[model samples]
Every structure is written in structure tokens, then in C-alpha cells.
Target: MAVIRQLDSLAPDFDAQLELLLAWESVADHRVEETVAEILREVRAHGDVAVISYTNQFDRRQLQAAGDFMVSASELQAARERVAPEARRALEAAAERVRAYHDHQKQESWQYREADGTVLGQQITPMERVGIYVPGGKASYPSSVLMNAIPAKVAGVEEVVMVVPAPDNQISDLVLAAAAIAGVDRVFTIGGAQAVAALAYGTEAVPRVDKIVGPGNIFVASAKRAVFGQVAIDMIAGPSEILVICDGETDPDWIAMDLLSQAEHDEQAQSILVSPDQEFLDAVERALEKLLAELPRREIAAVSLKERGALVAVDSIESAIAISNRIAPEHLELSVANPEKYLPLIRNAGAIFLGRHTAEALGDYCAGPNHVLPTSGTARFSSPLGVYDFQKRSSIIYCSPEGAKTLGRVAGILARGEGLEAHARSAEYRVRNK
Candidate 1:
């Protein structure tokens, strides 16, 4: 039932559909902004009182003080006991895989010495503190906690604080267990724009952090956007999306199932398949029909597929890659023969899955790379969440008299070219005095 369009059917008007694909990118009404802004101001003004009140009103958890917000070690242990043995083992496996992948992302400080006695270096240091927002409701994501916190741990961040919404003052044992596994320093039962505000502007219970990282809903996104100056935040993530590039050789059933995997995330999700062969196109359409009836989330995935999904018949695999680059999808699958051959052509996409056996779902759970990625076309400029996100880099420079004389002359010349007299003098002072 998804929109099936032949290349010939795409008139200039069809470009409009491509644009509509960005509907989730629409910023909510200023009313939401004004409302969130007011909530932030309240948290800023009243500290813990406003946070507690809003938590009660929104999350329905009446907290008398900041201490009530924290999840204790006992609760975490209980969560481990409550979780199924299989689930716990699976989570442990996922954590191990994630840590192994991010270990490769850890940065090291390096210095380079010049012949003129100048030493230039870069020092990579972790943030002293960071806050992670994990969604509540149907959005309980223990996988996300592992994705966000393990990197901070790997980066040697001193403190990792987590804020999650819990409607009944009951936080998931599973999420708490994941936090424990990732070595989170604290867990707060608070969420929404108010939780973000609490993280940005320290409450009596929540300490202001240097950065915030994790996935959230629209309100959480807007709050992060609002608090950017006060605290660092990961990218304002767009909606979930997946693009599968298949050849006639791959099974249409696999293609259909893979496409639905992302579409089931939400009604606003996007799924698209690109292929050069029409026979494969027809087969995929038939497979989608057969599979769509069997899926438990058929209604949601069906609407998402029909509204935002696509089956594009490109002229060749090269054209498919060109089209995919333009889309800059969050997940790109090369479900073709020898996917490695085209890896060089893919300059965009948040993550790439090489070969038909490597499904995007592998990346979501047990695969090593983080699932938290830039969505929409932001992948064209951004990247997946990594240890680098948890750390900051500073330039290290040391110059002796000889080095100063050699470097300052060029610095003075550049400063003078920009008409920055003060800057020129600052550089020239070293050379002149030396």
C-alpha cells in the first residue's frame, strides 16, 4: 500500500513529495516554545520547587525533595532480579559489543615538535559532568542508556547523570540495570522539558552539567534547543529513517521486512527502497503486502509506509547511490552483490550496513556502533554518537624565542591583512621583544 512511483511518473510536482518527507522536521508552534520557555524560567527561578511541582503535574510523581528524585542502588539491583535471565544476558552482550566498538573511538592527546622549537599538540579531555535524557512511556530505551553512557565512561567523563520520565515514580528496573552496567553516577526520575531545564540549570537535586546527550520526543528536542547556550547538547535529532538499496538478486521478503523495521518506530517514520530492476520492485510490493498483514504493528507501519515510504526504480546501482546521498538517510543498507565495492561512493548516511545479512536492526541492538544518530538530511553534516561526543579537545602550543620569531612574523602578517592592529601588535611583540 506504500506509494509506488516509477521514475517516469515523477514530474516536478513529485519533488514536493520529497520535501514532504521532511514533515517531521517542522518545528512545533511558538505556543509550545513559549510554554517550554515558561517552564524553563520556572525551574530557573524556583529551583527544586518548580521541578518537583511540574514532575507531579506531568509525570504524576510527587517528590517532596531532590533526594526523592534519585534512583538508589537497591532499586537497580531489584531491576536486575526482575529482568528475565535471557533479557539480562542479551543486554550484557549488547553492552560488551558497544564498549568494544567505542573503545576504538577513544582519543589520545598528541604533540608535534617543529624544527624551530615550537611544539603544537591537541589534548583530548572528557567533560567533568554530563546529563542524559531517556524517554519514558512507550519510549523506554535501555539500549539508549547503554549507547549514551558507555561512551562517556570510555571517554573517562567524571560524572554521568541521567534524567528519565516515570509517570508513577516507578522507573524501569531494566533501564536502571543498564545504567548500572554503563556506570552512571546518578539517576533522576524526572523528564520532559522540565527535566531538561533541571539538567541545564541545576536544581537542588540535579546538578547543572557540561553537556546533555540522548534521544527524546519533540518537547525534549525543543528544550535542548532552548538550553544550548547554558549547556552542550547532542544534535537536535530528526525522525527515524531507513533506506535500503537492493538488487534483483536479494529476496523481496527481506527487503520488505527491513523497510518495515524502521517504519514501525512511529507513524512519522520513513522507509524507502531503491532498485534498478522492475521485477524486484513488483516482488517487494507483493512481499510488503504479505508481511504487512502478519506484523503486530501493522497499522502504524502501514500508515508510515503508505505515507512516507517509497519504491524508486533507478537506472543503475550508481544512480541509487547518488539518490541515497541526496536523501542522507539515518540508516543505509547496501543489499546488493559485493556491497563493499560501493562503500567508497557513499559519502553520506549516519550508518552503513554492508551486505544483505547485515540488517540495520543489528546496529540498533547488538552491533557495536551506537544507534543514536543524526536523522533527516543532517547525516550529510553530522555523525553517529560516539566517545568523541563525550570529550572535548584543546590545542596545545608552546613556542621558544626562535619559534616565536618564526611563527609570529606570519601571525603578524595575517593579523595586519585583517586590519586587526591589536592582534598584529600582540604577535609582533613576541618577535620584536625576542
Candidate 2:
């Protein structure tokens, strides 16, 4: 029973419709902040002992020892062998595509000299170590491994340590295969808040890293959010979401199935559609009912669509674009004729799917763009995780005597305006000595 709110009839209540469809608000409650805080402190104090206790309690699995927790080379090789040849080929193809796309995002350290011989530039360097967390609960996303680790590897990070949960002391073969493809240096069997804490503070086995990245559950997100100052984090990701904008003429079945595709992700996931025609809206509703019946995750999809999804009929496509900008969805699909016409109008969206043929799922798997997009309406400010996340920048400036003398006056004036004598003296000293 997904809510169908007709925009024509409820023109004055568009705000309410927008609010109902915004699942991020509910998911952004930060409910586990205090819980994560306690776990982080305990893990920080007790180290590996705390991690083992929490894993056994929450994961309902026992680890004989810390040495047994680390994935051995033989174990990884066996997991790789277990992967079917076709799946391996597909993983390799995906790795190739991901590597190719991120290779272009690699940045170079640059410098330029002025007439006075002031050489000012930026020096790009890779982080010494980085940690990537991969979830292993109800679903396994091998693609996430490639998305998180490949960028760090390309950036020349010294070490890329990975942590994946073992709910029942089991890690999927696909995940291990993905780790191999992405060039992870170490793989640890840990997850949830403890995994994040271990990466941030460094357990006996897991090494502390300069930064941590990847997707995870609520406890994991809360732990990352809690340990922000100690180590860098990519972004505070919320639940997955997708929004599709269509004209009245598009196929209702296509629209309905597209919405459900993202809805099946989880109960907290949201799917939204905006169109101007009432007839098409009705058709999509019927299509959802017909199509949802066949899905294996029908119950989850039903709960998600009924509670968090929406269909809004705006007065026009222009109105739809305006509303979408305000919402700032993670994945935006334009199911309209000549969608490029509206491209310039989109000021906010993590990833833009061009037309009816370009569904969000394509972007999730094989598309060139990283699927690790900003969630919880963060597209307004944040960007997708990329090669830049793994690299650090340093200011490079070599001012010759003439260059220092030429630049000192301006620097001294600005320093004086700010009432900082030390800053002014430093610049004055350079010029006077020169």
C-alpha cells in the first residue's frame, strides 16, 4: 500500500509529500551514537580482547584466538579457487573498468615560477595506510571492495587493510576474490563498531590507518562518526536511495520496476518518482503491484515502498527538477525524452542516470562513476569517494630573495591587518635579509 499523492489535488501539500519520501531523515537519527561511544572506549582500552568479546556476543560466533582471526594466504587462495570461472571473469572485467575510470582521476603535483622566481606549488602524496570496511551480513557486495580499495592502491598508498565481518565465522568467496583483485595488503575478520575502532586505534592484529573508508551498518557508521578526530573518514553514509524523474509519456512498467529495484535494498531504503501526468501515475501504481509480486525480496520491498517511497505528479518537468534539487537524492534517473535538456538544471545529485535506458543499477556495478556516493542529502556539499580520498596534498613554496622581497610587503600588510606581529615579522625578516 504505497502512498500515491496526486500533485494536482495536493498542490499546496508538496512539502508533506517531499518529507514523507525523504527516508534519509529517519535513517540520520544517529541513534547508536552513545552505544558506539562505549564500544569505542572499551576497544581502545582493552584492544584485541574487547574485539573478541563483542564479536562473540553480537555476531554469535567464537574465535579461538587472535591469530585465527586474520585471513591466511592459503585461505584466500582456496576462496579464490572456489569462485566460478565466469564469476572470476566478471570480477576481472569490473576491476578493469573501475581501474580505468579512477586512473583518469589521478592528480599530479604541480609547480610554477613567477618572474621574481617564486616557485609555489602543491605536492601530492599518498596516505601511509588506509582501512576499508566491507559488510557481510544478509548481503555481500564484492563490488564495494573494488570501489574502496582500488582508489587507494592507485594513489600509491603504502598499505590497504581491509575488514569484513564473519557473521558465522564465514567470509564469502566473492569477497575474498574482490580483495585479491583490489590489492588489499591485509584482510581481518572483524566488523561493526569494533572493526571501525580497531581500524581507528589499531588492535594487536589490525593496524591503525591514516584513514578509513567503505560502506557499513548503523553501528559501523556511528563508530566512524564517533572516531572522526583520531582518523579520517570518507563520509557519514546513510541508507541507500534513488529518485527517478519522468515525463508522463514514459513506460509505467519501466518506472515502477525501477523504483522497486532500489526499494529491495532494505526497509530503510527509499524510491521516489516525479511526473506530471495523473494517468501515468496510476499506470505505475498498477505496474508496481504486478511486478512486486514476483520479487524474492517482495516483503522488504513492500515495507520500504509503503513506508518510505512516493510518487508525486508535479505541474511540469521544471517543477520536478526544482523539487529534486531541494531533496538532493543520491541517485537521480531522468526517464524523460531528451533528458539532456534538463541536465543543466540539475544543481544537486550524487550520480545522474541520463535516460530510461540508464538505470541506477548500471551505475552501481559496471558504470565508470564510483557507486560510493554521498547519502543523507549530502550531495549538496560532499562528493563520491575517489582517488583524491587516498592522496594528501602539501603546500610547496620556494621564494627566491627577489621573490620574497616582492611578496613581503603584501604579506606584511595582511598580517598587520590581522594584528599578528609574529606573522608580520616572519615576512619582514625574509624581505629585510634578502
Candidate 3:
């Protein structure tokens, strides 16, 4: 019954066996949320003929219309000239290092002034369109198309589109040459929840998209949780976590191949491992039983290491980073030897992977960041998938009639002490005489 499960961070109901090994229960099943709420009310009322009748009934495809769901531009330039010049130089070096790490998270428009000249800051912008989904039949993620369309074309998104699903008509020419080397713009072949209801309710052949980033299945995560407020969505993700820690001087077969790289990503992935060395957690449980029998995904990492893997023993390394900030893992891996002196005691993680030859599969492809993280414990709140999730800030303000009469008499005495008589007569009509 036990292949992996060593637990005991001084057991005695060790936090109720680590909350029953990080209980998952990822919702979506009232007959898959009534078949994704009737496929989002039949694609918001038959748009593009209900996304070409749910892409010819769930991608078996014999589509006659909805312009046979786009994919042109000479089929992304004939799949970037039939790839394999060593996988198009590894998809143009993972889309030029994920577009130079989301061009250092772009974000511009500022402002300043004050001393009664009043003007405040912030503007940002970006999302005029975005969509990205990807997960097609039998997985071929060209690195989830450079981690979801190179951070929406490095956050200057003006289009992007994408989608995937082509079960029988088949898709993935390295996900169309990593969406023409990550400058996506368009491509479809439709997917589940009707390509997220043709990119969240817009279809004369899909258009509406102000935000919809990737990763799907479960009727595209219940149609991106039913077209979230008509668009913006990027986190319904769960299953896939790592944890790691280790200071027991590495290599128990490199922490059992970094816990079988998120336990071969399935059967609800978790894979844990802490250490204050109980003989390095019995030599990484016999190197996860001799590399889980030379995995070709050993039966989905042996039912995700015999149901949500583990291997603790801690009592130090500050009780394995306070049990890794109470399981807020997505992928952590500090394999120690001073991995930045325990990386500012890691508050919560979506991606950490420090020393011991840092590998959470090199941040899942060319390590340029945004592997679209924040799973399970939602890294305590949220993040990863950046170019600041395709920008959008706003804020600004302007004022200045002597800073609107000293901020309109301090906003008309805090808007009539919050009783709000028309917000205190609209801040006493800018206070010239209030």
C-alpha cells in the first residue's frame, strides 16, 4: 500500500497529516457544471453558429463553416517551415526567452505633480484582445506556446487569439510552430467549451477577448468558470505542485528526479519532500523506487506517487520552511547548500527553484518565468503569468484648482462623514465656497 509516504515532521497528527496530504477536491462536476452551463448557453446564443456547432461536436471535426475555424497565415507559415531545425531552434529559443522575460514586466504611463498642482499616477493599458488556451488533444504544448503567447506579446496585446483542440482533424505542428514563434495574433481549430465559447462570447469566427490566458480541459475549466465576468480569466489551475526543500546534501538521485518532475504531472500531482535528514528521507525513498521503474510516465507517476506523494522528517531547516509556508507550493525546490540562505524564508511560492542546479524542469521550459503558475494554495493569493497579466491599470486623477481646493476641502469632510449626501454634494462642488 505504501510506495511513498514518509511524513512525521514530529508527527502526532502532524497538522492532521498535513491536512490529509493537501486535500484537493477541485470542484467542477455537476455533470461538469451542467455541461459547462449548456456550453455557455449554446455559445451565448448561437454565435458563429454555436462555434461551428461546438467545433463539429467536440473536435471530431467535419466542419463546414465558422470559416472552418481560422488557422491560416499559410497555416502559420507551414508550421514555421516544417519545424525540426532542432525544433525550430527550440521554438526560437523559447520565444526569445519568453520575450525577454516579459520585457521586464512592461508598464509605463506615469505622472506626478502635487504641491497643489495635483496629478497622481498610473495608466498601463495593453489588453485590446487576448485568448491563448492551447491544451489540444494528446498534449503537444510547444511549451504551452511559449507559456501562453509570450505574455500576450509582451503585454502590448492587440490580438493574440490562438485556441487548439483538433482531436480527429488533429492539430499541433509543435502547436503551430509555437504559434509562429510566439507572436500568435490568430489561429484556431477550436477547442472545448467551444474554444472557451469562442474566446468568451464573440464569434463570427471568434473575436471577443479582453483576457483569457491558457490551460484547460474539464470543458476548458468549466468554460473558464463560465466566461468570468465576460472575459478576464487565468486561474482555475490546480493539480501540479512540487515543494522539495532538502538540505540533506542533494542527489538522492537528484531528489528522485525532482520528485518525478511534479510526479509526471497527473493523477492529481503533488510530490513533496522536506528534510532534516532521516537518512535523507531514506535516500529519497530508494530513489523513488529506482526511478519509478524507468518512467515513460510510470503509470502516471505511479498514481501520483501512491496518491499525492510525500517524504518529510523535518525538525529543522526551520521545520522545513514552516512546512513550506503551510503548503503554498506550485513548485518550490530549494535543494539547499545555501539556496539564497533559504530565500528570504520563502513566504509562499508559485516558482522558487534555487540551487542544486535549479530545475523545476527549468521553470517548465527555458526558465523565462511565467509558466502560468499559482496553483492549489494559489501561492497564497495569486500571480505568475505576467507582462502583468496583459497590463490594464488606470488610476491617474488630475484636480488642480489649487488641487481642487485642497482636495475639495478634504473631500467635503470625508463625504459628510460617509453619510454621502451625493458624496457630500460632489465634494462640495469642488469647494470654492462650500
Model 3 residue 206 CA deviation (Å) reads 2.6
The per-prediction CA RMSD against the true structure, in angstroms, equals 1.9, 1.8, 19.2
Candidate 1 clash pair list: none
- How well is each residue in 1-434 modelled by candidate 2, as lDDT tens digits? 34333444256776775665673543244457877888999999989999998888888788867886798767776777789999988888888898899999999999999988889999999999999999996578899999999989989999999999988777789999988877888999889999999999998888999999998877888788888889999988877888889997778888888888888999888788888887888889889989999999999998888887878878788888988888888999998999998999998899999887887888887786799998778899989999999999999999888988978888999999999989998999988886
- Mark the regions of model 2 whose C-alpha exceeds 4 Å error after superposition: 1-10, 23-31
Candidate rank order under TM-score: 2, 1, 3
Winner on TM-score (1 vs 3): 1
- Put the candidates in lDDT order, highest first: 1, 2, 3
lDDT for each of the candidates?
0.87, 0.86, 0.84
Candidate 2 overall lDDT versus native? 0.86
Per-residue CA lDDT of model 3 for 69-165, tens digit only, reads 7888788879888877898897788788878988988889899998878889998888889888888877788898788888888778888888888
> What would the per-residue lDDT of candidate 1 be over residues 210-285, giving only the tens digit for each residue?
9999988778888999999999999888778999999878888998899999988988888988888988988988
As a TM-score, model 3 comes out at 0.35
Q: Which pairs clash in the backbone of model 3? A: none
State in Å the error of residue 422, model 2: 2.4
TM-score of each: 0.95, 0.95, 0.35
lDDT of model 2 at residue 253? 84
